[model samples]
Target: MDIRIGIKDSAREIAFDSAQSPKEVEEAVVAALDSGHLTLDDAKGRRYIVPSAGIAYVEIGSESTRKIGFVA
Candidate 1:
């Protein structure tokens, strides 16, 4: 799944791909916001952490299969 995190005062948002489910991601975000910190592990084993207060919003993209080549 593709996740986009909007940071306060930043023009560019953080984007990453995670293997976790949408519900799990949402829960984690909510938990982090409530606790003042957000941490997430991506499918590639990379960790992302940010202050919940600094987060403007979180956009969760739908999981889609990668397509190659052009289709008529």
Candidate 2:
């Protein structure tokens, strides 16, 4: 899954890839917002934590495959 996190006052949003389902990610974001902290684990086992209060939005979408070479 592809996830993008918008932070308050930040020009660029945080983007990452995760193995978690959309529902799971939404639940985690809600839980973090309620608890004032957000934690996420990526597909590579890397973890990320941020302040929930600073989160502007959370975007979750399906991953897209990158195409190489030219198509006719």
**Number of the predicted model whose TM-score against the real structure is largest:** 1
Superposed Cα RMSD, model 1: 1.3
Write down the TM-score of every candidate: 0.90, 0.83
lDDT of 1 by residue, 1-72 (tens): 999999999999999999999999999998997899999888899999999999999999898988999988
Cα lDDT for residue 71, candidate 2: 89
TM-score of model number 2: 0.83
Pairs with backbone N, CA or C atoms under 3 Å apart (clashes), candidate 2: none
| Model 1 spans > 4 angstroms off | 68-72
Candidate 2 on 1-72: residue-level lDDT in tens?
899999999999988999998899989998997898999998899998989988999999976778899989
Worst 10-residue stretch by lDDT in candidate 1?
33-42
Best by lDDT: 1
Worst 10 residues of 2 by lDDT: 58-67
Query: Candidate 1: global Cα-lDDT?
Result: 0.94
